[model samples]
Target chain A: MKVESLVFMLITFAVITLITVSLFIKVLKNNKNSDEISEEEQ
Target chain B: MPKNEQWGTRVGLILAMAGNAVGLGNFLRFPVQAVQNGGGAFIIPYLVCFLLMGIPLLWVEWTIGRYGGSHGNHSTPFILDKMGKKFFWKYIGVFGIFSNIAIAAYYCYIESWTMSYVYHSLIGTFRGMDQSQVAGFFSDYLDVFTSTTGIPYEAIIFYIICLALNTWILSRGLNAGVEKTAIIAMPLLILFGIFLAIQGVTLTSGSRGAVFDGTVGLNFLWTPEFDSLLNPKVWLAAAGQIFFTLSVGMGSIQCYASYVKSRKDIALNAMSAGWINEFVEVVIGSCVIIPISIGYLGIDKVIELTTTGGLGLGFRTLPFLFQQWGDLLAVLAGVSFFGLLFFAGITSSLAMGTPLMGFLQDEFKFNRQKSALIFGAIIFLMGMPTVIFFNEGVFDEYDYWAGTVSLVVFALFEAILFAWVFGIDKGWKELNKGAEIKVPYVYKFIIKYITPLLLAIVFIGATIRPENDDWSKLSFSGWELHNESIIGQLIHKGIKYNNTYFSDYFKSEVDGVVDSVYHFKGRDYILISYIDEKGLTHTVSYNYSGNELTVNLGQIVNAGDIIFKGFVINRIFYIDMARLLLLTMFISISVLVYIAAKKRKQEKENK
Candidate 1:
């Protein structure tokens, strides 16, 4: 691949992957926190 | 709010929503769209549209769904009905239900091809076949009348099995049915995607029988046409991609969102689903078909194959390329590739069934199992023409109207309803109800203003596509319609230089009742269409139009009788009939909605 093309491809992929992973982790953490809260209430 | 049936878990809900958005388009259509609409430069507009249009629409659809679900409504018709006070709101919602049923009809048929390919892959049907022979395998499958492949009525059989599978899952209810299937399928889909993408990027020129470097294809896909960014059409193309790719406008997302529990974080959930689809499209989608195909066939052949469509490239070409990897690996590649498509297809098709099932259950008091069966039967009936007339133009007709046009129309309406009609203030509150991640405040203005304006641009750009795709050069001085434009498609009016395609035949209005059509041509033929008392019909190589030798067929045609039968080439009635069938289906669904609302009114009065 040309350097410019490779750079374009990498940046696009990295940005999307970053956002997806971040949102996924945040959602998981929120779910875990709720489970802990309910467990404490129990 | 989530009274009837709720998603089993947060993960399941997200997966289910993701599964709905992440479909065949994510893997197949996205790359082709990127290639056609300016390659790497396309991503800028794509991301911009994602923020301005796709994400905002996702929030709005979810807000409408949860609002409706809170009011004991789960379908688009009743949801829109509840959201807006006007009666016509429910009618606009008809696109959600009708488009699903119409689209599901042929969509599941295409899904069946994936299942059949999986079967063929496992059995090694293409083991020793050459290129044309491999391509012949697909054509044979499409020719429903023939039974060359040992499976008699092969197309119909697979279609039944696919529909049955969808119906069975839908019958299992939302939690067990859609959510459970997503939990399993989405993960496996990702795995297959990752595996195939790895194989694609690692492709060497001579390694694994690759004819060219796979990385070369990646370059072709990623190389930006900076010049194309200056064109308005590129932006419209990007906007259109965001529109279809996120699977908004179609009632499927709204129906899925309606099941989400009240006070659950819809904002985060919608974001997760939308971004997951984007990840699959941009990262995984770009990695697979185009790279591998270019690696094998070279970029020139790959570009040529795209004219047949992404489905063609994925189905007809990929198998032959995978065959170069030797037997065991070829089988694995085929199974993974086709199996990935099957899961992607089923998840989306399953989304289509929900709004119909919701309508039946909430309105007519049908149970889940019964509703699933009815939905299955309706598709089976609607799908038959597309299956039998697969070679003819019936399938494309359904896809053009129901799948493409209906989606844009519905999305436009929903955006208007959510922001303007329902009041953006309430809709914004609805989006941020639960205590998860707070949505940024800028979306408040974007949702109300920017998204709808972009949607209108997408709509106009699609319908009245400018000449040469140059919006600046567009002029009304010598205006001529492109056959592909919406208005041109509606009336079948355009200057078709090629006579190979069927729907290209212009359906003409009655001018003088066709005095006579004289047609004879050696090299090329121009189809001149005119209407008589009977209806639409066309003539090729007529004396009045283009062509040298003209032979009048007045003696064969009775003077008093209608000269033409409103048909052309081979698929005379089927194309027109397909349009009629979809129109009838839309009206029928709308009628059902009206009757459902009336029954609800009666029940309330009695109470």
Candidate 2:
């Protein structure tokens, strides 16, 4: 690939990876919070 | 309404939403638009529109869906009724339902084409075929089930199979069907896309003896022509691509969002989905198609193919390139490529159908399976004409109205309702209800003012543009005329030749005639007559090949005196009339829905 296109591809991958990780972290945190809330109520 | 179906998992919901956004357009349509508009320069406007239009609309639709879902309403009409205080606002929401049904009818047929092509590729049907033969293969496939009347059985069968698959999955309810498929399919789509992109860029030789690096194609895509950014057409193209690639304007996004919990982090999810779609489109999509074509056929041939519309590259041109590979490798590559397309097509097609399914279940309280089956039948029956008569312009008509015009109209309505009617403050709060990151405050004005202004410009500019007005015009080689009837008038006066007629007519040569009936067989013709700005009457005829003939009327014919022949025979008029009638029917239905809603309100008040 051309240098420009290669750079574009790398940047895109980096952005997607960042977003995916963030989403997973948020979901995990939300699940943990819900579990803790339920335990406290019980 | 079955306690308002909710997504089983956050991951599954995001995957399904991403699958909805990532579609055939990502691979096929995006690269072509990018190359045609301004190559790498196109990305500037594209990203600008993504921020200004795509992301904002994504958040808007998600917020609308979640808000409506909280109130036991999933479809657009009821969703808008909740968002907008006035009764007339729900009537405006009717465009959403109309667009989804119209789009799904043709979209399902296109999805079947991918499935059929996948099967064909696996069997090596396109192996060893030349370019013309490959083109002929696609043409012949279109005619395979064609008949004089009713739907072709071949098309009907494939379409039924496609619809049945979608219906069965949708009927499985949210978690088991759409979500599961998305979780599986979206990952495979990305993997397949990466594999193809790698293979495309690694090519070392052309089939016809050209030696080149695949980076040449990459350079062609990324190298910017700065001048094109100044054109309004490029801006519109960028906005349109953003809308299509993100699958924003179609009520599908909102429908999927409706299944999310009201307090879910819609802002981050919407941004992630948008970025995922853009990754598939710009990085993977641009890498796969252009590099492969350029590596196999050279840059010149690829440029020639790009002018023929993006679908041509996917359907006709790339199949020929696949034939140039080693035997086992060729088969493997062909199957994988087409299979990726099939997965992409099915995911998006399913999203198109889901909103209507939501409507049936939420509003009418129909069972999920029953609604799925009924809508499946409706979509199948509606798609029959396009399947049977695709070459006769039925598909194009549906594509133009639903895919192009209605999308913009519905999107414009959405922007207006969210920004102006719902109040930007409320919309922004809804968007950030459970957000992981806050949206920039500048978008407050952008969504309220700039987004709708941009959409209105696109809509109004498209409407006032005369180029699309002449739906009947067969072709134009020179001297642009807006309508097709003028060409029919030229044909009536014995202008039976092409470009030579223009020279001959201007020269006043009465005897310079070319007998070319062989050229005219099986071709649609049109006559056009117009008075020039200088008050001189000119008449012309042409065919689909862009051949033109200028007729000499012997004496000066006045502006209204021009007579047309063969123009009335064009099938485009019938399609236009049908579209007009369909719009009329939608308006009437909108009025009835308003009355019904008012009556329900009255009944509740009396009680």
Candidate 3:
């Protein structure tokens, strides 16, 4: 594969992966905190 | 919302929302769209639109949905009514219900095709078949008359089975039904997608009848075309793809988000869902179809294949391409591909049902069971016409109006309602209420100004798409309405069927001598355009086949002479009937919303 295409693919993929991963982690973290609170109450 | 219908887990809720967004469009539609709309550089406009339009719309839907849910309103008609001050907003919400049922009717039909294909794959029906035989199975399956698959009415049977399955699942209500299905389906969808992508990318050029390396196709997909950013059509395609891929414009996200609890972070949830859809579309979707096909057919052949039809590439071509792998691998590939599609499709179709079910349960005193049954029945009744009359362009008619036009129209109106009428300040507050993460402040401006402006442009561009996709040629001065515009579509602009003649007739270039005239097998449209002396072109359109005309087979016709003229409306009746059916569906749903509103008023007065 050409370097240009490889760089382009990497950049695009990395950008989307970054966006998704960050959000997903936050969602999981939020869920964890919510769960912890409910469990503590219980 | 139902007492039992709230999210059992945040993970389940996120999975279901992601599942709703990450659908067949993410895999099947996006790959074809990216390749056809300037390949590698398409991501530029795609991501731009995602920020400016897609993610913003997601927040809007989620905000409004939770707001409605807090008010005990689950469906769009009531939800929109709760959000917007105007009386018409509730009526405009009819698109949410109408588009879904109308779309679900056909969308489920496609989901059935995936299910049937999975069954066939596991049964090893395609084990010994060559490329043509495997490809031929799709058409043969579509022909309800043909018993080639040894099952009579295989298409209809699968469709019924699919609908029954959906009804059964939906009948279980939120946690057991949609959330459980999402938990099962979404994980498997990602797994299958990853498996296929791995299979695609690792493919060797000469290992198993491949003409080129799989990585070469990846290169073709990601190689940037910096110039494509300048083209309006490319930007529009990216916008449409973003709109559809995220599944925003359809009221499904709103319906799903409406189930979220009060004080939960809709902002983060919406962002997560939108980004997950992008992950599916950009990474997994891009990797599978094009790479595998190019691994076998070469890039040129794959590019050429796109011209036939996007649907054809997925259904007809992929099975055959997978056949290049031997028996075991082929079957596995087929199962994975079709299963992922089925999962993707069902998730979205399941979302389609929620809005209607929400409408029924919240409005009428229908239980979840009754609502699911009624929704399924309505879909079955509405869907049968498209199934039975597939050849009369009825299916395409439903897709064109409800699937494409209705979604855009609904989205545009909702954006206006959210930002302009609701006041972006309050809308922004609603958006950020109970948010887990800080949404960028720039989105306030984007949601208010950029998003709606982009949607309006998309609406106009879609409603009156320029002939040949060149905006420079958009002329409204009685130039024949032979485009994708609503008016053009209403007239069934140009003969879409097999037998038709359409071309520019340059009178000045032609000697007045008679040229050869040909006979049409059937239908309306032998549109002949000729330029006048003043350089203005005049179009003479006629349904010559429907009339007794002087034009005959092998007859000579002079330049600028209209050989045939009359109404060439072959399936215009079906088209009109289809439009009427959609209009009726819209009106009927709007009536239900009105009655529900009135009932709510009466009950409140009594209280």
Where is the poorest 10-residue window by lDDT in model 3 chain B? B504-513
What is the DockQ ranking, best to worst? Answer: 3, 1, 2
**Candidate 2 stretches greater than 4 Å from native:** A1-42, B1-3, B146-153, B206-211, B466-569, B577-581, B584-599, B602-607
Query: B1-607 in candidate 3: lDDT tens per residue?
Result: 2534787778888888898888788877888878877888898898889889998999999988888888888888877887786788899888888888999999999899999999988888876677777777776677666657789889999999999999999999988899999999988998999999999999998998888899988988888888877888999889988877887878878888888777778988888887888888899999999998888888777776776546777887888778778888988999999999999999989899989998888888789999999989999999988887676678899988998888889999999999988789998998888898899999999999999999999988877776667776756673444357777786567544322333322121131322333453234334445555645444444434455454543344455444544444345566667778888888889888889989999999999
Native contacts matched by each model: 0.78, 0.29, 0.78
Candidate number of the best lDDT = 1
Q: Is candidate 1 or candidate 2 better by DockQ?
A: 1
lDDT of 1 by residue, B110-131 (tens): 9999999999999999888887
Clashes of 3: 2
User: How big is the positional error of residue B48 in model 1, measured in Å on the Cα after superposition?
Assistant: 1.3
Could you list the chain B TM-scores for each candidate? 0.88, 0.82, 0.88
All candidates: TM-score: 0.88, 0.82, 0.88
All DockQ scores? 0.73, 0.32, 0.74
Off by over 4 Å in 1: A33-42, B1-3, B494-572
What are the lDDT figures for the candidates, one per model? 0.82, 0.73, 0.81
* C-alpha DockQ for predicted model 2: 0.32
